[model samples]
Target: MPKTTPTPGVVITRSTLHKAQELAALSYGSVWTGPSGEESSGEAVARHLEATAALLATNGWDRIWTPPTPAQLAEADAAATTETMLRQLLDYIREEERSASGRLTAGDALNRVARTADGDPDTGRIAGDVLDLVVVALTGHPSARFGYWSERLNRTFADITALLTAGALFARTYGPAPERAA
Candidate 1:
């Protein structure tokens, strides 16, 4: 009998060392808790991989990408807005702390946001953001540095993931049968 080809499934593109540099920067910055001098490109890569592995181990999500339901998307949208407002508040507090006590704890800002928010603190979006960051760090390609990396990477990946996720959701919601092939 003739040999048959197996169906093509998900294709994961591995990160090249050059590509990994950018990812390392983004991922390391995302979870960095060490002193200023502690982070290097190589160290960032290690931290990125470690943090991603830990999240995967804890979450037990076998699939790399899952389409979000309409409700989940709405929740994520709300969470994103909250996160933006919180970041602005945190920045202002940091400046105030610099001029006053010369020290500020993130807990203070986070607690204040939660306390002041009028409605539900839609924290579920944080999980989605975290997952998106992990995915980008795990798969992103390196490029020329333009500006502040942490903010730039987060924004860049957020937009990218949103587009990709929307496509996935569209397919899942209205696409043809999975059995049909090109």
Candidate 2:
């Protein structure tokens, strides 16, 4: 038998995409330099993946891509290995940041997101601005560079999980379909 597709309204919305894109931008950065005077690309990639994963977590498949059955939701959780990996990377970032710079203020860390594209109605523009700041911070320093990168990744991950959870709950409370028969 041919497979049947779910209804159109059952998936994630454009606003969700905008939000993910914003979060992703905030997460990209340069790699940290170890004591040996070398940088690790793996760290950078980890941060990127973590940010992407967070986006996924927040705007889960059902909310951002399509409406999934219970089985599909379970599969999504299984596929989210990125979340675990990102968490590890974040720990590394935090350690480095603490060692290199003592401690960074919240305003210093999230300033990028707050200052970009004032008065612009486009959400994407704001997101892009936030991303640029992350990129600058990651590449700018030698000591705590990796830490900044890792923290952004962790933040992204948190954003994703929160969004996904919120989307799921929203659907349960307000989705169009009647509750499925047990």
Candidate 3:
């Protein structure tokens, strides 16, 4: 294959490492606190994930992504309005926290889905946006970052667990399907 020339007026994206360096600068510069005093770096990433999710939500990310299911991974092809789907997710979070036992906490559900969300990017990104909402929506509950991980992996896995938990939350809403009768 021959090297291709760039199109005029179009910009190429920076390398992932470069992009990460930029975000890392922003991530560390940020400061957030709760009743417990300063948040952990991972906790700060949780807040950043929440803000990033909110920005994506406002820009119509949800409308473009389908809910996860037994049949498919999430795709940027949802038919529902972003607001409608986000509302349902919010309502579902409320329902789960209000009464659903052993199944509502992102901090824990993240454990399994996190267990599984290892190699897929799309599934992970959608799940990140979704879990940020869930953990934050649940309120008073510790985020997976703060609740489940230690300092060494805090910031890195905070991002990972957020995505995994979001995927888990959406899966809870839409899939894994009913068990077949034995």
Q: What lDDT would each prediction earn against the true structure?
A: 0.31, 0.33, 0.34
Q: Tell me how far the alpha carbon of residue 5 in candidate 3 is from the true structure, in angstroms, after superposition.
A: 55
**Model 2 C-alpha lDDT per residue in residues 39-146, reported as the tens digit of each score:** 323222233333433434343322112222221112334555898767766776666555452222222322222233321112222222333333333233222322
* Greater-lDDT candidate between 1 and 2: 2
Kindly list the per-residue Cα lDDT of model 1 for residues 141-164, writing each as its tens digit. Answer: 233221122223233333333322
TM-score of each: 0.20, 0.17, 0.20
Q: Per-residue alpha-carbon lDDT of model 3 for 1-182, expressed as tens digits? A: 32223222222122322332333234433222222333223322333334444433343221112333332223333787898777776776666555422322333332333334231223333344334333333222223332332122222433434443343433343322224200
Best by lDDT: 3
Better of 2 and 3 by TM-score: 3
Misplaced by over 4 Å in model 2 are 1-55, 61-121, 141-182
Candidate 2 worst ten-residue window by lDDT: 64-73
CA RMSD, predictions in order = 21.0, 24.0, 20.5
Clashes of each: 0, 7, 3
Instruction: State residue 53's C-alpha deviation in candidate 1, in Å.
Output: 1.4
